[model samples]
Target chain A: MGFLGYRRPDGSVGIRNYVAVMSSVSCANGVVNALSREMTEIKPIIHTEGCGRGLADIAISTRTLAGLGKNPNVAAILIVGLGCEFIKAPGLADQIKPSQKPVEFLVIQENGGTVKTTRKAIEICGKFLDYADSIKRTDCGWDKLTLGLECGGSDALSGVTANPVIGVAADWLAAQGGTVILAETTEMIGTENILARRAADPAMGEKIKSLIRKQEKLTKDILGPLAGLVISPGNIEGGLSTIQEKALGCIIKAGNSRINELVEYSAAPSKKGLVIMDSPGSDIFQLTGMAASGAQLTLFSTGRGTPAGFPIMPVLKISSNTELFRKMEDDLDLDAGQVLAGKSIEAVGKELVSLMEEVVNGKQTKAEINRQDLLAIHTVGPAF
Target chain B: MQEQINAVLIHPSDNVAVAIREIQPGEAILGLKQKISARQNIPRNHKVALVEISIGAKIIKYGETIGIAIQGIEPGDWVHTHNLKAEEI
Candidate 1:
């Protein structure tokens, strides 16, 4: 099957063509927001990771900034920075230069101040919008798609219906030669052995094991004793008792596909199929990593429901129960609750894939229409 | 879709069932041949013991060990943090 998408010069396909205005550091956020406000077509990537961070955090921030700019969904990028930030505007733009897309750099410190930089950004972004508008959607094969699989606000039905249903769709896309990224390393606590067992080889399996172990140790060091829960209190109220129960449900979103490789946060996949990314389980943070890793779209399963989306990509929200679906009708895109009411997973999976086709064809999701674009970078170390 | 469903046994091997609807005390859950009645008010999405569980026995839900019973749990008992604790992996 094929969907309408924007074909990038780097051979990547995008379902959205956005002119991105990104802040290299928190200091330039106001300018980035102001410029994006003037242009409705401009997507603002305002984040808080330009300075006062450890080396690990700086590296993560740099990679995340470069990846988002390089994402095929962004037709043009305008990076704004404060001249003295650790991550410079030019350095950030240079990282995305390989994408060969239109990239402009403006510094608030160098270009006078906020007002001048905003003016410069407005003029620059206007040009980007012109370039972005010229890009047309072309027919692209399903093979060009890279999907992000995610779950949040999980209930008991999440494991049985929503996650398993998304899993079925994930398997379908993988069979079509598409890439699927399974993130939230903390959610893989109990199910690491199960997932590792499905790895391509013994070494890959060991990598999966170590990733989970590392995540567990980090959480323990940060949160003290209750770190075993890994999940939030909301998850417990949703019927998940422990991390193991949540992990069992979480891993089902990957389907039964063989894991190809394990990647670091914001790192793009090396090959197509199922790839596990090391990232925290926070909904927005995970979405950021997935989007930066080149996922064209994200399929988010929820039982309690959430209205989170990315600036450039559409987040397809699926709910497992009819009550939550009715309650969050304005936010959710599809209902896999039918599986719990007796429909087959294959049927819901087919419906999900069909919905994906419509979304790629320019059908805006509830998150997109509502403009719930929340972006956050996953930083590991403390700021110093 | 069947309306007003009260509970769902996720897996055949699972020793607990999730309450799809709030199951009142003494309500007979369907699909179980033994005709077990809820011993107490079981909230929706919460677990109900399908079989008697001894102290320190694994509280199996989703066919996986979610926690272990800290006390003897009778069939139809509402299973939660009060009598169960998260298992160490």
Candidate 2:
């Protein structure tokens, strides 16, 4: 069955026809945020990057911002930049122009300051919103959909319940020809060989192995045997002493599918099947990376409960245990804890897919309803 | 009365099982041969060696080697950071 979606000029399918305003640099965040306040209809994406950084960070920020602007969920985008910044607003607008969407830019310095930029950006967004509203939604196939696989705040039940359920749903989407992205390099430390074996070709397998091995070496220096970001007193108490055991829980959400293509952080995948985006294990960074890569929606599972949602797309939260689901009833969307109560993963997965279909059909998830709009870009280097 | 399970063996080839709930010292691990009893207090969600493992042997869980035994481990002994060391690929 197809869901209603907006067909963009560049032939991309968008589940949400949102007009977005983003800051090209941290200095212009005030103007971008002002634009959002002036026109609440426009989604504002504010980040702390874009200026005074090394070449690697500049490239990463530029690529990530451009990617976010080109995402199919965004009908049009307005970039606000401090003129002196390394990553320019015009550059970001130019990069996103190929998407055939209405892309605009306002330099805070050139536009007389934050006040003028905010006023001008508001007017631009007003027109974009009107144009976005005029667009019509048509039935789009699942093949046009790309789903990001994410899990955080995990408990022991996460691997056995919610993750496995998410895995089944991921497999279902893959079978329907939809794209699924499995990120979180830090979580795949021990499973490098296993993931490598699942790759579609020898070269892809080697790439997968190398990517995970690199993460293992990088994170191993920080906390000894523990993978970065996942080492907590809770994790230690839960019997996850090694990176492999911890990562094994996270990779299950990718489901049992042949690895198709592996892309750099925030880069779009060229293949159709299950792809992997090289992203950090941190929730917000990874979520933004997936959004920048054009995932209209993401499936997130949590044991302790994380309420974060992307500004441009929907994030569906699944709770591992029934207690947490009940506690976070207003925040979480589904409960996979029924597996502990004798319900099968297949059944929960089918329910999750149904919810996904409803979401794609315009139904809002808990994250969307709560407006948990959070965004953070992953960086390779620190800002100067 | 129904038998209650205390630990979970995630894979057939795994020599370690995770304690689903805390098992006291000398308590028999459920779902296994009655001969094996907990050698020490196995905390909830912690690993318990299901078989004898010599030092430097790879510790298996979920059918993959997660770490190596830094010290000799016996059946029902709690295996954690103290006894296991994570290896780099």
Considering just the first chain, candidate 2 attains a TM-score of 0.96
TM-score of every model?
0.84, 0.84
Q: How accurately is candidate 1 docked according to DockQ?
A: 0.31
In model 2, the Cα lDDT at residue A352 comes to 95
**Which 10-residue window of candidate 1 chain A scores lowest in summed lDDT?**
A338-347
Summarize candidate 2's per-residue lDDT along A282-321 as a digit string, tens digits.
9999999999998999999999998889999999999998
Per-residue alpha-carbon lDDT of model 1 for A1-384, expressed as tens digits? Answer: 588899888889989999898999998999888776777778899988989999989999899989999988999999999999999999999999999899989988889998898888888888888888899998898888889989988766888778877888898999999999999887787766667778999999999988888778877887896876567788788777777777877787877789998888988898899999998889999999999999989999998889889898899999988889999999999998876575556778899988988998899999999999899998877887
Model 1 per-residue lDDT at A37: 72
lDDT of every predicted structure (CA atoms): 0.86, 0.87
Whose lDDT is greatest here?
2
